[model samples]
Target: MDIRDLLLELARTYDEGKGTSSGVHAQDLLRRAGEEWRHLLPAGFDAEGNGGSGGASRTPWIGVYDPDITRDPKKGLYLAYIFAADLSTVTLTLQQGVTSLQAKLGEGEKRRRYLQSRAKQLRAGLAKDLVEGWDARPDFKCDVLRARSYEAGSVAARTYDTAAMPTEISLREDLWHMAEVLQHAAAVERNLRDEMASSGLPVTKRVEGEEEEHAGLDGFRPKDGSDYYVLIRQRKIKKSRSHEVLVRLFGEYIEERGFVPITKKMHPKDIVLRRDGVEWMVEAKTVKRGNPTKAVREALGQLYEYSHFLYEEQGKGEPFLLALFTEDIKAYAPYLEKRGIASVWKTVEGWAGSPMAVAWGMVDEQ
Candidate 1:
């Protein structure tokens, strides 16, 4: 049966008026279903708790099901169980600690004394539970299975003897299940964050790049031959310092476009595209990822700097294009537009075409 069907059946069996089965609600039924069919679920948190400001801290707990059961063909047989924690118990623990701490602090500055005493008691209680709980429960055999320990944020693996069960499961299989669970949880968290943001909650924004307006040059003939000189200067600097991959890509693109691409290794200005005695200076930048990191900002700034040099030194009166090549356009497009920087946001498919290019026009002084 499908997951939904199986869940419904479990819920019906556990319904209030059901026979010997406990009258658990649908949600609880679903939570315990993983344990009932432990052989079919992935491993992870059995219970997750998110606390509100007024309540106590809830510790998340997870259940691991035996992976040897082969009853279900669709989902194998192993499933890890998860359930939500009760908030009342968490609140009580917090209240108890607070009361004890306050009473001790009132008599003297016994902060360390109170903390040490409380910790000792807590550890003792946990140890007592571990010894008694495992020993008393026949179903909880330590020989076949071991409880996994977690350090800080890292999870240690719990392994069970597959040969002990009817089916032979491996440690690798258990690890794979654990990894899957973590990945799924992460996706869920991201979805929750997106939902919260969409619900008009205040979100933090991290701005990494300078916010400045830039303009591209339009058709305007330079009075002097200084524009050519500046272009030469910037090109030289760019060729010397730019990545080899970028340099090769730029050269190939220029050649394919049938434009004379000149590289000056001195104090160069812009990448000049000359055709039919007309020149279009393009300030180019290569963006690998979409996120606006320092490197991305620096590349953009370099592009703008080259544009400035072209307008001031070169006699080319055409609009300068701030051509950017990147796989991720959504993240960087708005920022580029906000800064009044003309950009070409392109994927692999559109990079060879001019339609993907966006140009921010510059004002010409008459």
Candidate 2:
């Protein structure tokens, strides 16, 4: 297996693949990733998660998780391979933090001790070439978060320099590191007070929908999700499964029409759409129950920027807004139209295409 080849495939196919023409959907991602690594990954440990805005990002990555251990990476460590925009480089990371960790490992000295011991051991090994030459320290990677409401705290990480090592070294370390790094983390997850996670090993089945909170993120928000835009950009976290699902569904809609999607082509829009000499962009936002208004409203601004900055200014394509919802948001349709953008949502009647969609000539089917 060529490391460069893998990086190319990750950056290209995952970042801008065939199914991605319409947009990258969750199933497309899962299928693509599951196929790519099923041969390499452990039976229960699947490589998943379409990183950063789903369509693509400067730092797009796919996370490998042992579902039996803990799906939420913040609670425990998951292997993540991140690719650069050009697909010319990559970074293999250990997904870690307090919320996801607490969900699996719980709180107090014992948990901290284990993490520190493992962290120290990793540091010690890297020093002696037990692992490849890489900066394995929290000091360099920690981001000092600004949460005015709470005490200022930090999250650190060491940026991976993909150019530093021989191909064999990076490839060998990736496999070796994945198997070794999370074994202890997975084993001790049973110590968590949550009954479902009390068993320290993989399970015969999987459960859906666990209520988790990001205290760090919420601290900066004004309870009404008012500071959503300000706080969201500052969040350096993993993509939600729901977001992936929405992308997948939207991707399907695009594929059926045989339209190819150019993802993250413009920074503001998640994916750019084109057909019949009519080109446009769509910025998708998943609806969070309490913050539907905020999510849709912010999406309007993002769509406008993608169009105005990347299209209109440069004499290019049109821009549109997409709000993915598991429930009805027809009431917000007029709001989107008022902003001069098309609104899209799901319904029992199939995709709820707003009047703006027909008016803008974006969805030919509409």
Candidate 3:
């Protein structure tokens, strides 16, 4: 049977009691489901199915494993297809291994809180729209500790009602995309580990949003600009790992062109490119599909604000303002130029930029 049929059959026949006829049937069907799911596995990945230990389980699942990250669900990141307690819906999820967190943080509420917080932080690495309809924490009727842990450790998921399951083709596509997303997360996590190592800090010792010495800037210096501090405090700046990735890439790109790029802890700007005693402040923003304008709008404001408070107001002179985007914001190039902000955005081949940005030698014309 296909995926839809398998899910429907299992959902219709699932029994909660141990060793019941329906329970046995559910176990057999789940095994077949897991076997079928193997076809959807990406290269170098493997799959496993679990119906229950001795009896039946409230949540039966098939786990897809990347050996580099984990082959066991108790220790690392993996993809899982989990059936709800009521069998009303089945969700495909990218989830962390909760036992590992428990080992590190100890069990109970402390571990639970850390699980959710870590998931939220890692979720930032993914694009907003990529997981727009998914839950960051999926609670599949946490009657058992395993079920509760699954809810606590969820990173992202797409759920489908059993009454209307998707076709096998769409299921395959979703699995592929989810796997790619998992791979991206792995790469970013490794980069962060390397960064921590280079800074001579243990990976476990770093904390997000930890207080650090503020960079010398009007917005950050309370005595220099209380108004700036008040304004900044009121504005809730959303942190994003996708934004970090873009900034790093852009910084490397500029550095390759013989410019020095600087980013410091608690820095107001994304990047500072310097050459020949001249500096350009860059604000990097990641673009979501169908929302390039929103990215441009945000970057524009940041570019202007940083230039004013970090440079112009401080008599550092107006450093050149540049807005960098993950994708082409060329549509707003003219709009930004009229306001004295140079715009440069990424393209598959190289980079694209506003005329002023090109003239300022920020990016090569594509």
Best-matching candidate per TM-score: 3
Q: What's the lDDT for all of these models?
A: 0.33, 0.48, 0.70
Candidate 3 global TM-score: 0.50
Q: lDDT score, residue 125, model 1?
A: 30
> What's the C-alpha lDDT at position 328 in model 1?
40
* Collision count of model 1: 35
By lDDT, who's the top model here?
Answer: 3
Q: Each prediction's Cα RMSD? A: 22.2, 18.8, 15.4
Query: Sorted on lDDT, highest at the top, how do the candidates line up?
Result: 3, 2, 1
In model 1, where do residues sit more than 4 Å from their true spots? 1-242, 265-267, 288-296, 313-319, 334-342, 345-366
Tens-digit lDDT track for model 1 on 188-289?
Answer: 222221112453332322223333322333333444456544434333232212233344445555566566766563234335556677655554443321
Stretches of model 2 off by over 4 angstroms after superposition: 1-238, 264-268, 315-326, 358-366
- TM-score per prediction, in order, is 0.29, 0.36, 0.50
Better of 2 and 3 by TM-score: 3
Candidates 1 and 2 compared: the better one by TM-score is 2
